[model samples]
Target: MSVVSMLTPGISMNSFEATAHVVTQLEVQRVSYMLVGALSSNAYGIPRATKDADIVVSFDSIGVVEFAKSLGVGFKLDRQMRMETITNSIRNIITYTPTNFDIELFRLSQDEHHKERFQRRQRRWLEEIKREAWIPSAEDVVIQKLRWKRRKDLDDAENILAVRAKKLDWDYLNHWTMIHNTNDLLKQLRDECPNLDVLDEE
Candidate 1:
C-alpha cells in the first residue's frame, strides 16, 4: 500500500490554521524556522495524520519559550531540552491548549545534513490551509527521518520514496545517507517501492 493508503486519516484544517497562525507569529517576531515532520510532508509526500508539527528553528529553547509565551495566551511550553530516542537531539515542545496542538522546536544542528536541509527549505502553497509556508523538501524529509531511524520515521521515509523518487535530488540524498550510515535503509526503501527506479542510474 502507498503511504496515503496505509494512513487512513485526513489532515485537520484546524491544525493547519493553527500552524499558519503560529508561523506568522514567529515570522513577525523574526524567528527563523522551517516546517518539518508529517505536517510539512503533505507538500511532497502522502498526507498523513499528525497532531503536532515539528519545526527546526535558528533559536534555542530559551528564545523560543519566551516567544511562545508572549503570543497572547494559552500556549504552554511543556518540555525543553527533551532528547529524542534515536537521534538524541534536544527539542522544545510547546502545546497550544485551545487546540491541543504541539509545536516541537528543534535547534538547528551543525551537522552537514541538518544545515543543508534547513537552508534548502522552500516556500510552497500549503493546500491544507490554502497558504504558502516554508517547508522542507521531499529529499530532506526522507533524510531527516532515516537519520532518526525510528519505526515511524522509517515508514515516513518509505512513504516519501514511494511517491517522490523522481523528484528527489538523488545525489544529495545519497551523499548524506552514506555519511549517516543509512544508505542500506535508503536502498531498501527504494527496493520496496518498486516504481522508484531513478536511483538505478547511480
Candidate 2:
C-alpha cells in the first residue's frame, strides 16, 4: 500500500508531521523509498531521539527542484546536493520549517549492498510517525552501520547486535561484511555484545 494512504493527518507533532509530510509527498509522486538511519535502528535496536529523518529514495521521475516544489510550503529543499563518500550516492536535504528538522533524501546508489538492502527493506508500523513505513532489516542495519563507522553508528550497531543477535542471519551478515572489508569490525561489535550464542556456530 502507498505510504500516503496509511497516514492519518494530525496524528503527531511538528517533527513527526514533517517526516510524514515527506512520506506523503513521495507516495504522491510514486517514488520508491525506505526510511533509514536512527529511526531504522530504533526498530531493531534501542529507541532514541533524533532531529532528522533519513530516507533513501529511487528518485527518477522528476528533478529535485520540481520535487521540492511539489512538497509545498513549510519545506525547503536545498539546491546544493551532496555526494556521500562511503556509499558514493547523492543526497538532497530538506528543511522542515516549523520544527527546524532536517529530512535527508539519499538517492539509491549502485553499490551491490545498497541494492541488496533496499530490496530487503521491510514494512513496519512506526509509532513515532503514526504510520507504516519501510525500514532496513536488522542484518542490513548492522552491515550499513559498520560501514559508516561513526561513533553513533557503532553504538547503534552494538545495540542492534545485543537485541537481535540470535534472530539475525549470520551468513548474510558475514557475506556483506566480507565484501565491504568490515568483517573485523562486525566481529568486534558482536564480541562486545553479550549472549550472542548464535555466533558460536558461525
| All models, RMSD in angstroms | 7.6, 3.4
Clashing pairs in 1: none
lDDT of 2 at 100: 85
Q: Which ten residues in a row are the worst by lDDT in model 2?
A: 4-13
Give the residue spans of candidate 2 off by over 4 A: 5-13, 196-202
- Structural similarity to truth (TM-score) of each candidate: 0.82, 0.90
Count backbone clashes in candidate 2.
0
Deviation in Å, model 2, residue 188 alpha carbon: 1.2
The per-model lDDT (C-alpha) reads 0.73, 0.85
- In model 2, state the lDDT of residue 123: 90
